[model samples]
Target: MAETGLIQSRYRLIELIGRGGMGEVWRALDESLGRQVAVKRLKPVGPQHDRTFTRVLRERFRREARVAASLQHRGVTVVHDFGEDEGVPYLVMELLDGQNLSQLLEENEQHPLPVEHVVDIAEQVADALGYTHRQGIVHRDLKPANIMRLTDGTVKICDFGIARLGHDIGMSSRLTTTGLAMGTPHYMSPEQISGKEVDHRSDLYSLGCVLYEIATGAPPFDQEDAWAVLVGHRDTPPEPLRTHRAELPGFFDRVVLDLLAKAPDERPADAGDLRRRIVLGRTGEQPALGPGPLARPATGLPPAPRAKALPAWTRSMTAGRPATGSTPPPAGRPDPAAGLTGQWTAATATAPRTGSSVPAGPPAPDLLATLEGRHGAGIDLGRLGRWAEAAEVHREVAAERLRLLGPDHPDTLATRYEVAYTLGRLGRWAEALEIYQDVARARAAVLGADHPDTFVARYEAGISLGRLGRDTEALEVYRSLVEDRTRTAGEADPETLRARHGLGVSLGRLGRWEEALAEAREVCALREHTLGPDHPDTVISRREVAAGLGWLGRWREALVAYRQVAEARTRTLGPGHPQTLAAREDEAHCLERLAQA
Candidate 1:
């Protein structure tokens, strides 16, 4: 729209990328940033005179841009800037050097992408969407054209032009006010085509449609007419991928089907977790278990060429880097221990049982990581939760500590402790227990078993055991943990209180009501003193005391405890929430029990 072969000579509008129903993508040089970026522009600013139509069109683009920019994840497209150029609003995003899956499929119609590659891309896309959903955002449209695959093979999701956000856009959707259908018919979830309020799981359903295409080279439901496609998505059963790609991983095929379910609840609860599962499905060649940096070279694929030169101002913004660089820096602080080892005096000697001591030997955790090295974007592709990502990140940190400080370094063990704790968060109880036990043993050997770090790992091991559903085993673990933590951390410490709370939980699970109640009360009081009355953990301990009271047939006291939990959760977490609702429900149950008693 501008005379300078550019829009304001700031965005040198280069060649077009591809045109979609809502917008046209251009491979533009961001003269402001001195880097190449993709500019997605809406189709001719759609009928602005009719306020309602203008509102919907503008609002749609605006909301999508805002929400997309708000989210910062390596798997998601990086939105750099947004503004109006010559009467047309546009979005500036990281100029990814690769083809959209749509283009790849188009280029190779008969041969689908390799299953391993497909899984890798799918995991990244799902993880990105999963993170967005958790933040209360939903990608109303998820399709092949929106997913970008770099030559290095990392997937970046783009085009949130129609994404619905929890925040209010300048323009609101009356069509959406009535809740109308708005996604690609073939990729649309059944509930979405029917005009229902959507959430994160809806994105998962769309992901199923996309994954189905990746696996079989066709959308799950494709028809000659758009209407038929919509209807088919509503009623048709997707053909199983294994029917065509018999070599596909059976578990992954099941996971794809699980995402395609009609109801949101029927799909996986989180995209991050879905991504992790897909990641774990990869062959040995792919690194799917850890912290993911997003710097992979394009797979010998030529990037779409830029038509116009970036302006002098924009060139300055590039920080003098060449226009062709595609490596987006990895998220958070770069883990210093990317590829190195231990500095401790001895290779495997344990530190004393002293609390929090840096052993005289090499840092055991980093030493272990060095022994079993990890790399890549640290994208946690092999599990079903954010815990995978967290665990990997902590492991990476541990590795760096090992490399920088040496094996027996105190900082190294501290990082390893985090790794063990993070593993528990990911719901991998057996593995987490193993790691926790290892760290505890190491801490006890080097720092002394009575050290706070050793006791911490011991307590975590008990929690992990409980998560694994081994109540008797968990009970025994917790009993031991409580004793050790009490002696090492002291009864007044919050961690010691937490150990007591775990003991109470394990006791209750083992049907030892009296002991559970006694331990829980002690935990509640200690936590209140050490961590403050308002701390959520303290409140939870108090709630456990009530549950234990119920187990002992003390309904009145149980009701009191349940009421406190309900009120606290409502205040802290919010009402009508899944957790809050469950708490209130528990309160109701306790009240009913008291009435009966």
Candidate 2:
């Protein structure tokens, strides 16, 4: 490749950033987009090499580049473009302005990284593994040099679906007759050394080696000889992580050990589970993984969702409009002194109401339409984050519907449901609980107990119960709802699955972690099969599995699960979304657990 020239008339090579056995990585500019990019220039085969081998290499390069380009994720490096410039195949990727783990270790003078940073990186790598494995792609080579950590705290795995080229094509002659030394020997798994089939588990083992080195300042078997390192991976049991760093968290120590297991079966099930363990380990010490207390139950009957007090709706209205003692009423408006209150006289006879009727017929037909219009306006307000205004509008509509259509009317109950939702959005859990219960009861009576509308109301009631620390009540509600939903809509319905998810959450809250794990795993599998793994709801179910694993004292698996969720949420939803941040928070909590343990 030319030293300082344009490639394909689009990528202008600026300077060589790094070089490896297979290629040189250059800092370059994408003239088409006015952005920086990293250009990988594959080493050219010698003129004397067989045509068939060169053709095979070029084909493999194109196939791998295509696979890498197909990956659209935050945890994997983004490939911008790929092409051949004068027989030198090149790949253009998003220029990462951060150091790889190898660089970080060197910057730290070959010392171990901070415990928090080590766990964080472990979580990220595990998450990336989950995504890649799900796509039926194995990284084949995972080492410190292939993992990059950005300045914004984003960790990405590079050379996805293409690292094998470095070993298989670029350095084929370096391989011995026995077929050893395909990947960095320090991080190679036992199966890789034995020249047997490898899978995602092999990547886990390699990641273990990376985690061990980052946490303890050296790989598990840091032999100077490459062959000895390969042999050590196959035959030798690694020394305990604590042996090198006694101050390291015991939870982390156990996780690293599990990852280093020679047999793939002995490792965590997958990256999802690994992240979950990390989350649980870090947060296990807490009574609850998050805010919100579980309310104590009342005697006898199942604890009813409580309504503590009404929100201060009047406060906002009266804040700056205090009445003056001497203020007079506006012109033509009824004055208090002019009314019967001043004379204190009772009327001798009630005035006849001319327009009043004996029968209280259904409210004027136009009232329903007017109420619906107001309801829509309230929904629009809520969407704009004006929850207070929305709540007031919903409250007024609900009251009017009750007065005109009766408590059991679907429209009235629906309005009440909205009021509850708005109250919850305003953090008025008690008020929300009251309204949700009333709505649920009314809906159950008007529209059968198993009706979808009733189920929705009941679901909201359960959410309110959970918010007010009445998780036992919430659990009971969810359990009953699940059974009802299964009977009504079958086990595979999304609503049924939702109820099952709630039941799992409630179980977790009650500290029945083993039961919770079973429930969560069951729901996750079903969701994966029915909704697809990448669906937001399915991702949530996976997160629950991690939570259950963490609570069950499986820190390593929990860490993996949490990391997978965090990464998925960051991909499907933006990193700044509340759900994504929640996943990230769990990951951080797991790291903290490892640090303290």
Candidate 3:
């Protein structure tokens, strides 16, 4: 049991309520919200595991937690928050007063649950499974212990602890042992037991096992030896429910037996259909239990790219250890940017190109192919926050492109542009400025002076100049780019507004307070009209307006602007986001200035 202490300086631990080999659960108070929550802390892997295993486990944990928290159905347990404290990762969930089905079974001296109770659980579990499956998430682990029944008769599925996106095969394949599986063997589906691709049907198979145990006083395939149980699940057929309990409903037996089908296609098409069968079975209606209407496929956006694993050298500099599992940004500290994206997003305001561009002259195909791989490797390095290593990779790729495609070729310039980006991230402003200017010049010659790519390079040059304390040069770059962008992309275009916003920043840096304030107001207005008030870009412009107000000694107006930005960020990105924290810092600075005045 963990000693009583505060978690993340906010959740005050009251007592350890549950324990497992890999984690412990605590009843805790959310100091910020003044509410009780259940906190589950995953024990850090001991040195017994190699670094590779440890890293994989950590990534799996975080991914599952985030996926669990995003689920909004009532049949699912609520995930309030998740983060790390003192190097131990923890997940904060809604505290529920209920007994899991396993405990309920234990309370009854291992006898099957009452028939009505069994039906209710099956219905609720099926409903929850339906919701999760539609989101393309598979609960890899489903057992009696993971299904909870509240005293109010509400059943919620718990522990999405090992759940993963259906399409995520890379990590799953790595974690699978030769004979052993990720889930409990007795409850595991045949496909899962064989280490084959699993889908929503796997959940159906696991649910079948749970139902079988609760309805028949034991799992359908129970044996004293674990290996025998695995063999029975794979090769032997389960005895019909009537054999164990002659009084059980015939429809219930059919549903459970159908779920235990060896082939995925043989099971009910989805959990929703399974629930319909359970609900209608209680009525006189004939439940459509066999291969009914298939559930709608997952329509959610493709999963975001996983954060690149940190290489050995840069791990120390990447602030605080990466939690073994999903760690929510501490309250009010949302990670709003990817890698150096926050710094370069506005400066390089071009959208990613999805359509393939024909090369100027079919470039050396083999060299181009190799450069493509190297380019991705460089990007992966950057994502890991290894700026130095990323810069090196980009430099090598840029040199190779220069030799094969020439310096003026769009592909070559693109590689050089990435090199400059890494340089800027490393705070080598002077070095970055030279490369940015070179890329801008080359792009202008090849792609036209006012092209979006040309404008993007000039925008970065402006940012580099500003970083070097050369505000006049930076202002010139932004003024020209903003005018060109407004003409080409329209004033309402986000890229144009980005340039206008940069112009405002330059004015503030030059101590042109009045002009900066006006420019900030104008850009903020344009962004609000185009991007909505809650957009990250809009809030960022609003922050600049607050800065201009402070620069002009308008402390009252500055305080209000800063407060608004902070509140907006809290709503959109959560209060603990870095942007929200920055806004709070500005608010504090304004307060200090007001006191002095």
- Top-scoring candidate (TM-score): 3
TM-score of each: 0.45, 0.46, 0.48
User: What tens-digit string does per-residue lDDT give for candidate 3 at 1-597?
Assistant: 247888878889998889765567989999999999999887765654334334444555687689888899999999988877767778899998999999999999999999889988999999999999999889978999999999998999888866878776532321121122256767877666544456888899999999999998899888754434554565455789989998889999988988887656657889988888888888957653233333212323111111211111111111121111122223432122222224222222243123423233435557667888998898787776566677888999988766554555566677798888776655566888999899989767666676666777888888778667688998999899888888877899877787887787678667787998898899889989988999877776777777677667797887788778877877997764434544554554465455447
Report how far residue 68 has shifted in candidate 1, in Å: 1.5
lDDT by residue for model 2 (142-207), tens: 889889999998999986533442223321111111122235678877666544446777788899
Worst 10 residues of 1 by lDDT: 313-322
Query: Considering every candidate listed, which one attains the maximal lDDT?
Result: 3
Candidate 3 segments exceeding 4 Å error? 170-181, 288-597
TM-score of 1: 0.45
The whole-model lDDT of each prediction reads 0.61, 0.68, 0.71
